[model samples]
Target: MRPLATRGGSYVFPLILAITAAAAVACALDAGPVNVWIFVVVIGGWLITLSLHEFAHAAVSLAGGDTSVRERGYLTLNLLRYSDPANTFLIPLILLAIGGIPLPGGAVLVEPWRLRHRWWSSLVSAAGPVTNMLCGVVLAWISAGIDNPLGYALAALALLQFVAGILNILPIPGFDGFGILEPYLPRELLERLRPIRPWLPLVVFAILWSVDGASAWLFNLGADLMETFGGNVAQAAVGLARFRFWNV
Candidate 1:
């Protein structure tokens, strides 16, 4: 049931990364409109990491014994590999623009029975956020050592990765955090909760967006972690402030 994403179709994953790297370098160099280009790079880079995030789940699922991941194109780094296009990209992008929260980006379906152990399921769910956290650490480390506007851009991106990691691990419905908890829940309870999973993100989003300072608190925690991990908060703030594409 291996589904390789190479059927006379698109293969632009590497190209996307290359462009993002170029943009990051440009920002570090203080090229024209650093903030605008940083926006493009961060968004584009996030998309790629989003793909990898889902891929981590699929890969772990496969290791745990599910072969369906490949068949469903879950291994593909393409945005088109997502189970739902709108849910996969649009909702997250809109929310990030409005509230700065990067919701769980994509999903990879796995067969529960095929998992090697019940606990393996939790690992599969945890893998995605772990990858994000690792990415944030790497970015933060790099940003902390560098001196210039480039560090600012990298720090901002690192902040985003940290926030994304935190959000995905929150035990909310449809999110990996909750998925990790599913292995321990009773069958009847799981069935009762299943129906509302699809709407959970919207509910959470509405609450956070409507509640004053909710989103800010989330970002602040992420910022705290970023600083502790060596990210330059002041530099990141400058880049974040400059990333005002909507402020025309």
Candidate 2:
């Protein structure tokens, strides 16, 4: 474990460099009026949102008397400390380029049994999505306060983060939301459901692939909420990158 951590630390910088280079090359080769600034903002917002999600998990874990996560240094915004390069960087980019559904990676090295309360564990799990929603709201407010392309881009990024949060929180196996709900579900029920865990990714993928209209409906609903407070700015931001690309 110690060697893995050391190796991971060593490889982190190079991996990020490689991923950035790839993204830049992909963007340059694509034929369109790509808004580089908007892409940057959206990516930045997404990273920030991911950080918050992981930190929330660590925070709740600490509050629940779990020092394991703290020892692992996961209670901060440093994405490298938590992210799995394969899931967070490589796979997502590949899926995005190939027009497939992207899946974000979850946090690193934490033992749930160390927590003080099982309920707090659930709360910690749920915190990621909630934090993303809060970030979206804040970004929407900021976007409404200004009137410029940059503002629009920022708003759009926020909207994407919001959608990501909601999607991640869906109570499916291997998702943080499922972890949150697991504590509350009866142990016997979970045992019965255990057999279905391995097939969850396929099920989730199918849902995303098959339910085109459903995603649109969810986006529309999110847009409506954003518009209620921020008006057109919110709508524009939320819709700007609705189906533009998949960011795993």
Q: Per-residue alpha-carbon lDDT of model 1 for 118-186, expressed as tens digits?
A: 998999999999989998899899888978767776787789889889888888877889989999989
Q: In model 1, which residue pairs have backbone atoms overlapping below 3 Å? A: 3-70, 28-150
Residue 59 C-alpha lDDT in model 1: 92
Which tens-of-lDDT digit does each residue in 109-223 have in candidate 2?
5577888778877888777778777877887887776555456555665555555666678788777788888888888988988998868866775676578776565556656
- Residue pair clashes in candidate 2: none
The lDDT per prediction is 0.80, 0.62
Shift in Å, residue 116, candidate 2: 1.3
Q: Give all TM-scores, in the order shown.
A: 0.91, 0.75
lDDT of 1 at 247: 70
Candidate 1 segments exceeding 4 Å error: 1-9
RMSD of 2: 5.4
